[model samples]
Target: MSESMITKQAIASGFKQLMKEKTFDKITILDITKTCGLNRQTFYYHFQDKYELLNWIFYNEVILVLTKDLSLDTWPDNLFHMLTVMKENDTFYRNAINHSFQEEFRNYLLTISEELFCSIIDHIKVNYSMPEEDQKFLSRFLSYGVVDSIVYWVKEGMVRSPLELKKHIVSIVNECKMYATKHPTTLL
Candidate 1:
């Protein structure tokens, strides 16, 4: 990797390490720069703030794990894999989850989830010519429901096994599919 990439990775890695011990509020830009052996300007050159890093890590890295091979045929399995990934990064998520500004992170997560859901719905629409109104409704419900389920599971410490969570996700997806089957319409 180039020196700039190396430095950026260093910053990201350093921030990940710090997240284990300190909440975002407690971590200063200087601390991240010091830990990465980069100057403050170098850090600023890459990221505007710690929250921006958090957004990048969550959306770019984490979401890819959630959506990889994301065929509708195995969405529940993909979700299970995503939960496992989240468990591995539980410390970072927990820190964000416990922060006073947690709502910000939660909102960001929900927004990303909504976008992913819309993308999937768009795929379904293309396949079936679903009406715009029904498509919007299904996308809104599925997106909010799935994101809420994840948030609730995390809040409950993920007591259910992955298999069980998969069952729940499948049930929800099936219901939405059934609704669409019953209400299919042409997009004008």
Candidate 2:
């Protein structure tokens, strides 16, 4: 990685460590810099604020990893990987979900989920015609439901294993696909 990327990763690492010990609202930039052996200017140079740092962490560590060679056939595995990553970093993610930056976190998930659903919908459209506007609407609709389910899962202490959650989501999607296949002319 480049020096700039290395510096940002260091900052992200420090912030994640702090998140494990303290609530997101309570951890200051000074705390992160001190933990990471960097200065405030370095953190500021890479991120606007702690919230932005949190977004960066999600984008780089979670979304970027999930989007690699993503396809309808692989989305379940990708989502499972994301949940596994979140479970591995439970403390940081739990803190993020419970904190003031919850909207940002939700928006990030929504963006990724929408993209994933759009791809699935496009694949389906190859077999069944769907208006562009309807495709966009359906993708957004599914994205919201999936994102909210994830947020609820996180808030409920993540009782289900990542595999279990992935299976549940996959079942739901499969049901939808079955319905679409059975009633091809009605979905539009």
Candidate 3:
């Protein structure tokens, strides 16, 4: 990466490290820049605010990993991996979600979920011709359900293991699709 990207990443890394100790809302720009050995101006040159940095962290760290090597047939695997990533970074993620980063995380989840689901659906789609809007709508609906569930899990202290959560979610998704398939709803 170039020097600019390196510095930006260093700033994000510092913020993430701070998140391990405190919530995003409690963190200040000075704390992040000081932790990373940068200055306020340097931080602003790359990010508008700590929330933007949080978005960057989620997009680069969590979303990228969630979407990496994604395949049409690997929805379950992808879900599993995402849950695993969240579980591994429980403190960081839980702190962000519980704090001011909640909205950002929701928006990010919707966007990436829609994008990935649309790609997978388009690839594996059969003769059925769901309109692009319908595909996107369905993707958003599913995204909300999944993301909200994960948020709830985090709020409830993630009582379940990642594998267990993945299994349950995959089963629920498959069952929902099966129902929707057998019922043949034109609205879908």
Candidate 4:
């Protein structure tokens, strides 16, 4: 839309192409610049390093995936849309997902998971009476579980399709809630 947005998109698109062929550490600014047909200055003007660019992309996608108006009713569609976006950029994700700097991707997942868990806590508050401390604790605890499951799944080569995995995650969250109800003593 705007000049800055176009530049950002160019950088992201360039990075995705470069990543398909090499590791993140191996990627240089020139490589990205050359791919995008932009000079070094433009690249630096938008991002300090590859990591920063990666983070920008992750944050933009997370916001696009999880809208501010989301509720429990729309969370599934939002989640699915997020996965669809990821799959649409599968080359980018597969590269990052399987790259040497996978910790970056993990960090991205964790950050988004935190936001997702906060939404869950909000939904819980709407339906039940819970203390602020309890809400944060539950959200963080469940978010960690979801984050770990996603990391494990990604490492396992994503054996299931995006849609199937979404269903699996939803089921896992539901089961965790059931378990928590049955074993209230486990809450810490």
Candidate 5:
């Protein structure tokens, strides 16, 4: 990797390590720079703030990893994998939600989940003759539901297994497929 990439990775690593002991709210830019032995300007050069760093880390470590081999057929499995990753990084995730940027944390998941859902839905090319807005609405609804399920599972200390969550996800997807194939009487 290039030196710039290396520096950025080091910065991300430093922030993650700090998250183990301190909440995101408690961690300062200085803490990240000091942990990585880099000057404050270096951290600023790559990230505007700690929250942006957190978003970068989430995109890189979690979203990128989950979407690497993403396929429409295995979206549920990918979500399960994401849950497993979150479980493994429970400390950082839990701290992030409970201590800082709670809404942003949820919004990030919603954003990515919506993107994935919309992509898959488009690829399927539903022949149900629905409006474009309707398709997008379904995507947004399901994405929000899935993201909320994940947030709730995390909040509950992940008592349920990833497989259990996967099962629920699959069931929901199948039901939506069935619904799309039918002429619904109500959107509610």
Candidate 6:
């Protein structure tokens, strides 16, 4: 990695460590810089604020990992991996969701989910002949459901294993695919 990336990763690591011990609202740039052995100037050079650092962490750790080499065939596996990572970093994520940046986190998930679901819908439409409007509508609808489900899962302490959650989500997705294939005309 480049020096810039290394510096950013160090900052992210410090921020994540602080997140484990304190709520998002309570942690400041000084705390993060101190934890990571960096100065406030370095942290500010890479990120504007703690919230921006939190976003960088989510994008790099979760979004980048989940989206790498992703396709319809690998979507389930990618999602499962994403959930597993979140579970592994349970304290940081739970703390993030419960305190500050909840809406921003949810919005980030919603945006990615919508993009993924839109692509799925586009792929399905090659054989299903759904209207463009319907495809967009269905993708947004599914995205909201999936995002909310994930938020609920995290809020509920992620009691279920990632595999269990993945299985349930895949089952629902498969059912939706089956429905779209079987009743393409009625999917409005």
TM-scores of all predicted structures = 0.75, 0.91, 0.82, 0.81, 0.84, 0.94
* Backbone clash tally (model 3): 0
For candidate 4, give the lDDT: 0.74
Q: For all candidates, what are the clash counts?
A: 0, 0, 0, 0, 0, 0
Cα lDDT tens digits for candidate 3, 1-188:
89999998899879889999987778999999999999999999999998788888888777777777866677678778878888888888889888777777777777877776667556534646667777777667777888788788987878899899888877766665665445534646
State which candidate has the highest lDDT.
6
lDDT of 4 at 13: 89
Q: Could you tell which candidate, 1 or 6, scores higher by TM-score?
A: 6
Candidate 4 lDDT tens digits, 1-188: 99999999999889989987887778999999999999999999999988889878877875556664667677667767877777676667666667654676666666666777667656545544566676678777777776677566666766667788789878877776665556544556
Number of clashing residue pairs, candidate 1: 0
* Alpha-carbon runs more than 4 Å astray in model 3: 115-138, 186-188
Candidate 6 residue 130 Cα shift, in angstroms, is 0.8
Window of ten residues with lowest summed lDDT in model 4? 121-130
Model 2: per-residue Cα lDDT at residue 176: 74
How accurate locally is residue 110 in candidate 3, as Cα lDDT from 0 to 100? 76
The lDDT of model 5 is 0.80
The order of the candidates by lDDT, greatest first, is 6, 2, 5, 3, 4, 1
Query: Which structure is stronger by lDDT: 5 or 6?
Result: 6
**Per-model C-alpha RMSD:** 3.9, 1.8, 2.7, 2.9, 2.4, 1.4
lDDT of model 6 at position 113: 79
- Model 1, position 34: C-alpha lDDT score: 87
